[model samples]
Target: PISAAAFGVAGPIVNGVAKITNLSWTIDQIEVAHALDLAADKVQLLNDLEAMATAVPFLLPEDVQTLNTAEPVAQRPIAVVAPGTGLGEAFLTWNGRRYVAFPSEGGHADFAPGDSLQLRLLNYLAPQYGHVSVERVCSGIGIPNLYAFLRDEKIAEEPQWLREMMDQVDDIVPVIIQHAFDKAAAVPICVQTMEMFAHILAAEAGNMALKLLSRGGVYLGGGLPPRILPMLQAPRFMELFYGKGRFAQLMAQIPVYIILNQRTGLLGAGYAALALDESL
Candidate 1:
């Protein structure tokens, strides 16, 4: 018989009910147990990023590409930040027996512009969003928002073909990303859009490392990071990451990597289930 079960939701879980951030459905532990014909106490709910953090220690070298190897201090806290449909943030800390994942809503925090261009972009978005969060300019949706800024603000020309292509597509995020990676006949605006995305992402990641003092390392776990490896490797990304005034040296010492395994969250949930069963 199944002794326990675990689930990683893409939102906050409170009182055994998960209010998924991007989805309409609410996940209740009791409902999940009743549906599966298991005891309610045997099921556990965790934020998706938290579950992904659980799989960090178990990830193989081949599962990640190191951007920095600053020598992670053993047993120190580790941070995970992902930008997909929405941004997600989490951390893991050793608790004697094992590392425990802690979920956070840090992604929704206010967006801090790092340059004049970023400030202009923020001003452009302020009217539309009222309170521009990091997720507004860092996630999948943020790509288009950034793209629109380039075009609408006269920073880049928006050709008719690109406009038509985007209008016909169900999701312009992937289309924009594809054009960004296409150097041969690339759309200049798309390329710039992705560049801006990388800048903001790197900046936010550095902020996360500083906030948590994650000397264990900072891992990027998201659908976009792995696909945009070349863009991420650009010197501009690291430059922004190391832009911290007095703490640039400390930021330079923080190891950073891209989590290649997309199943990290599921794998972490499995470990959570094992942990729960062992305790029982």
Candidate 2:
């Protein structure tokens, strides 16, 4: 028999109600509790990223690919930065005997360029997107923006074949990523776009780590990270991540891992449900 229920949703939760972002669905804890024959308090809704953060303590050796080998500080805050359709951020902090997950909208925070090129990228985007957030150059949707910037700036030439291919697709991210990995084909523009993407992602991950001082580790979750594993493994990514001046040494000690398990969010939701049951 089900004693409690928990859900990891993609939107903010207010007063036990969640309105899913980019979707036309509204979830109410009272409705869910009534339908499940449980008390309202027994049902809980968490932002999707928070659920992923909750599962960090439960991740197995095979569930992730290590990016850094630094030792984790016991029970210190752990941060999660995921770049999927959009950038999602979350963290877990020790709460007495357990780690409690918290969601963040840090991805929507103002973007600060880490270098000259990025400053140029920002200037190029600001006129088009009045308030360019980190998500503007770090997520799946952001790939095209990077690609277009490089192309228009003449930093890289966009091949006619790739342009034709992009024209045929409704979503250009996969096309860009696929060509970026095509070593034999050597798509310069795609490669440049992906490199920029990795740099921005690494910088943002470092920003999150610094903000929370997540000595427990930083986990990279989301659809994009897994697909671009090679790029993240490249030395350039770590270079950008560790470019925090005096804090560079500190960032190096915060272990980083890329989540490979697709069911992490589900596992986290189950953990949350179990916690709910235990409290009752």
Candidate 3:
């Protein structure tokens, strides 16, 4: 167990050097050893996204659900995006025989809303924050903020039961989603909340793929995508994903898959370890 994770973009020391990202605390190998109670040489650090990206090619065929129908895995640039603590973006390149993956801080890119509605939402969001990054709007952790925004915007009404239920918890998206899927406690307002959430997500997904020009396909591999599996309306999601004006035609041809397996991220980490080992 880590006694404490302290750093400023410095990762664990591999050969006496590392950059851990979050900066609440900054410590070196000795500090890490003292904090974690482990042999300094035994502890290791790896970039979470880099580790996950390395696992793409290794994903078992059945682990991913194809959204668009295309199989150009070997011929072009392959990208993976995961929405964890923040949006993690990575891409891989194949040159006939093998692939190499690279990590990206592209998740921090400014959020560009596609339509008047999105712009309106941004206008509402901008006043509250410095710069509205996509992670500020699209990730699961970000969803509740949007929910409150919507609630305040009067886009939808929350019933008393739902309001009280929501007020009792820090995050209401997951519970709301489960309610929606169960059709048990999901009310009219809850359904509206999720629908709005989904639309924003779709728009972001489209923007991400377009920016990458990932012709091979886009696989939704984040923690949230699978939980909302019961509600994923491909046509609706596609409508928003490919809604870009000039590039709609091109975006339509690309494939998309949702990774169903919960262990995919872990698999990706293992794959990266093997790759790093092979390199050594």
Best by lDDT: 2
lDDT of 1: 0.90
Using TM-score, give the best candidate's number: 2
- Which ranges in model 3 have alpha carbons more than 4 Å from their true place? 1-44, 278-280
Better of 1 and 2 by lDDT: 2
The per-candidate count of clashes, in order, stands at 0, 0, 11
Each prediction's whole-model lDDT (CA): 0.90, 0.92, 0.67
lDDT of 3: 0.67
After TM-score superposition, the amount by which residue 145's alpha carbon in candidate 1 deviates from its true location, in angstroms, is: 0.8
Mark the regions of model 2 whose C-alpha exceeds 4 Å error after superposition: none
Candidate 1 residues 182-252, lDDT tens each? 86888898889999999999999999999989999999998989989998888888888888999999999
TM-score of each: 0.96, 0.98, 0.80
